[model samples]
Target: MKHAPRLTALLLTLALLAGLLPAASAAAPQPAEPRIAADSAIVIDYDTGETLYEKDADTMRVPASMTKVMTAYIIFEELEAGNLTLDTLVPISDFAAQISRNQARYPTAVPLPYGGSLTVDTLLRLILIPSASASCVAMAEYISGTEAAFVQRMNATAQRLGMTAQYQNCHGAHVHYLTARSQAILVREFIRRFPQILDYTSATSATFNGTTYPNTNQLLPGLAFEYEGADGFKTGTINAAGYCLSATAKRDGRRIISVVMHSDNNTTRHTDSTALLDYGFARLAADAPYTDTAFHWSWQAVEELDALGAELHPSGEQFRPEQAVTRAEFTAMLYSALAADGQLPPLPGPEESTQPAETAPPEDTAGEPEQPAPEPEPPFADIDGHWAQAYIEEAAALGLVEGDQYGRFNPDSALTRQDMMVLVDNFVELPEANGLGFDDDGDIALWALEAAARTTAAGLFGGSGGRLFPSASATRAEAAQVVSRVLELA
Candidate 1:
């Protein structure tokens, strides 16, 4: 037991980023394997493409409004290739406006101005957030001369993403058929590739030129069946589709994508999704490496950090929760936790970045002129030698950390609570907060005080017996706690 071979953690990154293998954090009272009311359903882990649950996933059924996800995917591809910009105007064609005018004839259509145009961005919002069939037709016409051409593209893209489907229309009205697995794969790929689509799908409501549009997905925030952390994808309901839905949510940095097709009603669609989501989370919780934190106060936090990935601690059996964490360790943990939550710092500007500029494709085969790569940042003198070096350096590259004015990272020094709060401030905008009312509030470093107060109100920091040890070195446990709370906030 003494020489456990550095415990490459068959437990938490001792909760580090390799992911808490074996859910050594173990199952937090998991629910039984879920049984759904839908005829076809599937649940998948967003990161690893692991199948967590499924039922008749390959059987074909009507897609209904779920087709908008495919439309949105094609639109994102256009945007990425610079073929279309958010500002690009898409004139509502007579054909599209005609459909929207008859909500009686076409129940899912939004009332669009037949001759007037809307921006590509606004149209996308209408299509995804509200599942507006008219908007979908408008975009289809703008992208292709006719809706037929856009349908061809959707089928081709579906084939490329390994989805099985026969797409009849942009809005899934003409009796579209897609397997539950295909829908899940479509959503997984959509999120993996164009997560920004969430900006629309997650919206509870949107105001168009003169009217308001509410999202059809009931699982998102401020809705009938609000599931916490649930954000995107689409919902489909029609006589043929029979209440189909594809739902996606993120919790503790792990994302779950679920698809339920051919449920009896709206209630069953959401309930089945909830069951699948619950089962998927429980399954994930029971996953990964092994370690016990000796039932510390930070057990939950440690579990959360471990959930981000594998750890590199020398001992798998013991996490040394009371150990005073070094600067490198804290920053590395923060980096992993934030990344798991998909909270990456924004990319540097073109002038400062080596990444290619977001330029549109050229008219001919002549490709973009290559730009010279930027110079590599000089290594932090005290950084490279640390085991957490890669994580620390990555954090530094994102401007999430910096060396002391002396150019030394001082990686080995103990991280005080004051410093921890300051580092967190770099990523999260601390909302205006009331006084923390900690006995040691006045003792906090002046620069860190405001951050401390804000974080305190955020419940990212807490006091014991009305005292916050501002200058005290944060232990591994405390750091884990802080990171987990930040994950919740994100």
Candidate 2:
């Protein structure tokens, strides 16, 4: 009997040790280090001012058009101080038009005929969006009466922002030198003081005087290589500078700024920037403590859900954390969350066409009978009489959801993690996933990679046992937690 007891104790000890080994090994998987084709690159966390990654960040190089970022910063400051207004019309001088003619070299210039009038807002858009050198001069002259005088203000502003750079002109057309570190600093402050610059930089195309000019930065909407959350910043290239880009993106609640200078080519500049952003996000995730503790995780999620007014279950008294969520249910939950956050647009009221009282005919035709308007068709085939009909319609209208190829909205089907990511991305701007590769990246569908990478970086989703179960069904509890987080952030 003594021998039997000793053997049993040894077997239990072995089993416990065996279980510990896998967990210990899986505790902290190392993230891949980022590499860039640029001669200089830097990535920083916007919230914490932490340097997530850098490569020769302080080496001086020709900044090219990126100098306009600083110029716009000054312009925004003046606007905020009430010294300049968006509607202030600036006269395009002969000198400005002549310099703008240098567009043959840059190919991003908007025509600025001498004596043509443009609002300050239009000129700023031309400078930031299309990289028109003439607009830079016009803005400088409008602010300081001459480009030389404007260059003085640029230098002064750069000094105030702690940017150690040599400026040779109002626009970045001359031999001006700026380090990646200095450029990032200038851009960070620009965004911090005037976050609305993103509205201009994020534009894929801007129209002035009926002529539409495409933005030089290709990482925006309607571009060849649009990154999900890329909103603002700039891109530049000169023979001497090669190619350069300063980019910023926000995901979840975290924002990252990346600068890549002296890339070998235009494609390489964008690629390097994307890689740096991925590395920054990966580092943030790796540094954060594991948030998957059993009871604590559930409790935290419950608090958010309660605050967001999320219902636990339809009939069950206990919250069934493992129950899968259907498409209709998830859409309703997301719609409710957006409504609670006041993020949804105002609903359209009854129009004159729909209301006979508002469209009453004159007294001479008062006796004529009013014809009833035909009912509009529902957006989805299967959602016509569904309980979640309104939610599905609103979601579809906002481009948040799409029906199957056969035009049938399968409302009862379970929602997959990949599908959820795609839906969430339509509402929230997601970060690029260039450098962050998962162990099971092959399992992710081609269409879902961008959303998965973004949601992962935002800390909204994570893989199970080092594998992202892209096709796995999302449970009701998980849906509640995600919706709550989105609302809280909003």
Candidate 3:
């Protein structure tokens, strides 16, 4: 929570940039780049590894927590190899626990209760979200029996990825004399090894157990150069590393990777990442075969006319795939698609729009045509009377709302840390939140698992009852508490 001040500063930076820029100016900033605080920066097309821009990129500097990106890659590979699964719980070793409790320059492990058990999936979430040092130590120990072995694995992976200038220590804490060139090479090597991980770095915000913590890398959000293609990588901070980031984004079927190290603060890290992403996308735009759309739909649009309540039509025919989509339209389309897919009930007709207050039929019902079945109650109505209902509706219209079993939004329900996570997860695209965290598994409710992970990661919610009560309703007070935190981080 102490990061509030830093987050505020970052928002101010974003606002100033937005106010000064024009929509048509998504192009990369000009060569007269502002005098920035970064020690190193580089941008390359992920598709061809072509260097788009570089400034002291080859100089070696502290890798800082950006080292976790490599650590995560190793963990992911192990998971893919069947060496690990979300359910594999690991105990905290003395050394790992020490790291977890160690209040290094960054906050220590989010106070994981001593000797507590956590799953590999959850461990990764903690590592990616808060850059929880203990989570990393615990994970390394779990995988290799010791941090030493884990470091060995990290260095081995580095060699395989062609990070010739890079090396590693047991804990990823910065060490002596790692040059900026070495850091850039390490980042390039990482991109070559786990090209798909861009998804994690670009996440704007995530929730873990109802607590939300935003990605320190501001570029993922539209705040930085309108990064429509931006998705993920990682962010880091330490006197040794300053502020560091490895960012990845896609556009027009092309992908680009950018790395910045030793930046001043939230402002510099954000601006540097933006400049790199901008430069990368600019090259692709110039090389495009023609004017291209930034977005397109993969699923067909459903258009209901009658008993054909569940209908599917080609995206281009029934709905223009090329047309930009509003949040409301997108959500409605999603709900309609789910209905067609049997995931949700059909939309209510005018005659069936309202539910009767009483369950039993009226006394005169015998003489009347059988009443049309009541339309499903709108989930959001339950909270209409709740304070902040307007804000909730705004979130819902943006597809940021969550619902209960009976399809009620339950606005008055007291929000858990996990609920906040679920809400943020869907509203923003963040790969790091996907199936990450100890409490997230098949047996757990999908919404709960997602919410717990995202909110926890985003620093919004903390779990209650040893688990996330996703079905629980949220109270106005509780919702405001969490929403205020989110807005702060945002």
Candidate 2 C-alpha lDDT tens digits along 1-490: 0011111111122233222221111223547878788999999978667788899998889989998898888899899999989998888898787777776654466778887878999888888887887888888888889888888888888888787788878667667898999999988888888988988888887887688878878877668768878887898877788899999887665678999999998899988888888888777665432322122334345445445554333432244556798888787777656655557554433334754465765567676899896666666789888877766765665556778898888998999988888777776755665423668778889998887777777777766777777898998778877877676655
lDDT of 1 by residue, 1-490 (tens): 0111121111212234333222324434445779799999999988778898899999989988898899999999999999999999999888899998777545576788857989999888888877788888899988888899999999999999999999988887668798999999998988888888888788998788778878888898889999988998799988988998999998867788999999999999999998998888766665532334423456556755676562424254556778887787787777766665667643332344678877987566457797796745544777655777667665565566778878888887999988998888765766889548988888999888887878888888887899989899998878877888887885
After superposition of all CA atoms, the RMSD between model 2 and the true structure is: 24.4
Q: What is the TM-score of each candidate against the true structure?
A: 0.59, 0.55, 0.49
Clashing pairs in 2: none
Candidate 2 Cα lDDT to native: 0.74
Top candidate (TM-score): 1
Q: Ten consecutive residues with minimal summed lDDT in candidate 1?
A: 1-10
CA error at residue 243 for candidate 1, angstroms: 0.2
The per-prediction CA RMSD against the true structure, in angstroms, equals: 19.3, 24.4, 21.5
Report the C-alpha lDDT of model 3 over 1-490, residue by residue, as the tens digit: 1111111111112233223221221222334433445888877766556676778876667777777777787887887799988789988776666656668633534555467778886777777766777788788888898777888897787667566445455335656234444455555655666654554555565566566766656666655434667776677777767878777777656667777888888677877777777766766554322223212112111111111232111232233333333222333333332333333222222344476488877676466677785643333646655534433443343344555677666543344434445554554444455433444334456546655565566656554554544544443224423433443443
* Model 3 clash number: 59
Give me candidate 3's TM-score against the actual structure. 0.49
